[model samples]
Target: MAGLHLAQLNIGRLRYEVGDPRMAEFIDNLAFVNDLAERSPGFVWRYEDDSGSAIETRPFASDPRMAINLSVWDSVEALERFVWQTVHKRFYGRRHEWFERMDERYFVMWWVPAEHRPTVQEAVERLRHLRQHGPSDHAFGWESLPAAQLWKSARCA
Candidate 1:
């Protein structure tokens, strides 16, 4: 059988103020959304820790605003639709209202085969790749998704 790979999506948010009310609402709903996605179409596996809760500042976790979650899915389209075409879309639209208004530096998507849930360290590297290179065969985003099918990452980004 073909090897399995799971596409991983990672995102982060910078906080101007930590205890803002809107920030609370964003956090609340973000968890709910992740919960919903875990059960939705093409869902396979996701990061054990919620992306919204984890933050660190170091070479690997250099961005204080950065957070992480990764999942293994059956197909890239399955993952993309779940991100842009669902309640998750609302979160995407309102990032500016809640977080810093930076051009898409905080979120990134890339492919891995099944059974491979990436760690925070791996997720950070993938985000770096997408920033260094636009969407390509190795690193990509939702807009650059391949045709409808599964993917197996010979190597993780």
Candidate 2:
């Protein structure tokens, strides 16, 4: 660990408004999954508003239907465990029912200082970098780089 936290941003285009009956199941599970992530090992922080989840936040100003999730984890492994090993996995499996299949990259990851809390603007820039340039040290995808190398590269950035 280089005292660098992993910052991740994932955007999804909703199939319907969150309050719609069609999205009830997904909306109903938000709190449980959010609580699970907060309690999970190595969890640091997540983007939230008065509603307690960022699902209502629209990072893409042009797309009201887009929902964004941004979070920081102590390490890649910690994030992977939370997403793949917990009850959240069930929601991940059913994501297609609520979210549209995006043609472009919907997620991006980067390294930040331990104390840094990334903003939505920063996340948008990272996602843009990933979309425009593919994966690089500055912005990457789910396929991660070695922590040592990633931290070194991030520092150089």
Candidate 3:
């Protein structure tokens, strides 16, 4: 617990191209939401490009519309508070307006050294592991809360 951090990666497919008028609202609010995260209590670090936005960094090259978000937090509660108790909740509730519905898992959480900054490729592999093998100490999600806790216990032991 003293030397670890929680890392999260979430991916989504856009309903339209970045320049499309329909995506204007989401695009405009991106900076605001990202800023909120940086100012939040448990914020550690977030992946950003030269434009200060990760939207254009398409890790999934096969889908140009896919967007990825990777960040580190002090704890799960910190991330949850920022997500559910902030303006982000509003935009998240309206995700259907901008992102397509994916039957597969698109979000993942894992543990790493406190000083470690996870890379896109590493996060992608964890996500893939979760999608293919389900939740484990390797990677988990909100739906698999127990696995998240399991890692902490294992580490302590």
TM-score of each predicted structure versus truth: 0.73, 0.90, 0.91
Question: What tens digits encode model 1's per-residue C-alpha lDDT throughout 1-157?
Answer: 1565556756646564445675777766766887888888888877664244343323244465555556777776676667666887777667667666556655566656556677767777777777888777666765565463322221122
State, as a TM-score between 0 and 1, how close model 1 is to the true structure.
0.73
Residue 9's lDDT within candidate 1 is 57
> Which portions of model 1 show Cα errors greater than 4 Å?
50-62, 146-157
Q: Please give, for residues 5-46, the per-residue lDDT of candidate 2 as tens digits.
A: 999998899999989999999988888889999999999999
How big is the RMSD of model 2?
A: 5.6
- Candidate 2 residue pairs in clash (backbone atoms < 3 Å): none
- Could you arrange the candidates by lDDT from highest to lowest? 3, 2, 1
Taken over the whole model, the C-alpha lDDT of each candidate is 0.62, 0.84, 0.86
How many residue-pair clashes does candidate 1 contain?
8
Worst 10 residues of 2 by lDDT: 148-157
Candidate 2 vs candidate 3: which has greater lDDT? 3
Over 34-151, each residue of candidate 3 has an lDDT whose tens digit, in order, gives 9999999989999997769898899987899999889999987788777777898788879989999888988899989999999999999999999999999999887556433432
Question: Which clashing pairs does model 1 show?
Answer: 4-113, 4-114, 5-112, 5-113, 5-114, 6-112, 6-113, 113-153
Off by over 4 Å in 2: 146-157
